[model samples]
Target: MRTTTIPVAAAAAILALTLAGCSGGGDDTTGGAGARTPAPPTSAPVTSAAPTPSASSTGGRASAHTEAELTGVFQRIQFRPAEFTTTDAMLDSVYPGLTVSDASCLAPFGVGWDTSDDAGTVVFGTSNDRSMTAVVASTGETAAATDLVEDARSALTRCADGSALFSMQGKPIETTVETAEPSLTGTDEAIGWRVRGTVGGNAFTLVGHTARVGGDVVALVGWDPTSNTTNVPLATQMFVDAL
Candidate 1:
């Protein structure tokens, strides 16, 4: 097999979506139910339709923190200024099939920073072997947002022993999943998980967290080739408090 280096940011992106139940492959034994037969490896990318407009879109007000304010919040949490912010359009182009079924999980729904809307994302660290990403967004659905966090908790539990089999950059890879306690406190809801596996002979570990704050949702993803543990809750709390 040809050697390939999956950048930390790229792995973070893939892991975040996978934890959201976006990536396809492997038996779905989630919910403590009977295992669903594993689907055949697919060459097609996973795709989802845009979220249905909620009443807030028409009647209630949907608010998001200004980019500058969000930037300030990230800075307080130890993230450097965003080297490059991504918009919804950019995300669509880069991740065509990536989608979050629950719009309440606004952080994963829009992926990276959404320049067109009130949401934005930032990447920190300069090392190619490690990277961290923070995403924050508001959907004006406090209850739904809270519920989304709970749903994520369930998904994480179900997928704890599952494996993700998919292609990255046209190369096939498999990652084992494990559940981790979400350390976030004083929040509406939160959960986390860890993924470990090898890519082109290079072993990697990814830690991811998703949390809901009032009417907003935030997700933090950290990737390291050498270490398996990451301080995801700290970064999550910083974004949640800022919201």
Candidate 2:
């Protein structure tokens, strides 16, 4: 795990594609074996759309070039300067998650505590009201990206259906994890999941994906109470393209 100072200019990006505001209409729970999404803000304006991420042939894997080199990528998703935070300890302040009910889920998707270390760099932010997070850390045991990918895959299996992940915020957000197809492409490996549960007593749906692009393991997440999961694949693609 290594750390790099984020350039001041990189924080001013304004092309937030995926999570500007929560999507509209209904939830789309029509996939399998993907990943998980972030919890929504307790209070947000319903003016922006939620988003996802994708990858490409070259210069896309943040690990191949530098450690935790995802500042620019998050910036592309409209994570304004004030919206960004590099301190891993303050994750709960930005992302809609805390400790999860199923401890196994923490290693991979939910909190990703085992994914990276404090020595590594963590860049998290909220786009408009949509929260997105990226961790550029090693597997800790050997700094191997494949190991982390396997961790996520194993988590999907161990924390099977009915597994509850509590993002204890605003009256406890209890999310149930279900497998989904990989919405992101051109990666060494990818995993996806669709989480449906309650936030503030209202039905909420989250579409999320985790992919190993080259030497980097990137996770994309977004949730809406309305269940509008349209173009989720494209949402992640937008992030992958940014890389």
Candidate 1 error regions (>4 Å): 1-64, 80-82, 85-130, 147-165, 225-228
Question: Poorest 10 consecutive residues of model 1 by lDDT?
Answer: 121-130
TM-score of each candidate structure, all chains considered together? 0.52, 0.57
Cα RMSD (angstroms) for every candidate in the order listed: 15.3, 11.4
In terms of TM-score, how similar is model 2 to the real structure? Answer: 0.57
Query: Tens digits of per-residue lDDT for model 2 on 1-243?
Result: 011222222321222223444311112122221223434433232222222233232442433423234555544445422232332332454333455566656444435532344223444444444344344332222235566666777876776444255555436665577775564435556667676776667776666666555545555555543322543344444444444
Clashes of each: 2, 25
lDDT of each: 0.45, 0.45
30 Cα displacement, candidate 2 (Å): 32
Residue pairs clashing, model 1: 46-97, 113-121
Model 1 per-residue lDDT tens digits across residues 144-241: 45544565565555444322433344444456766655665445666666767665576667677777655566666666433324335444544555
Total clashes, candidate 1?
Answer: 2
Q: After superposition, how far is residue 128 of candidate 2 from its true place, in Å?
A: 3.1
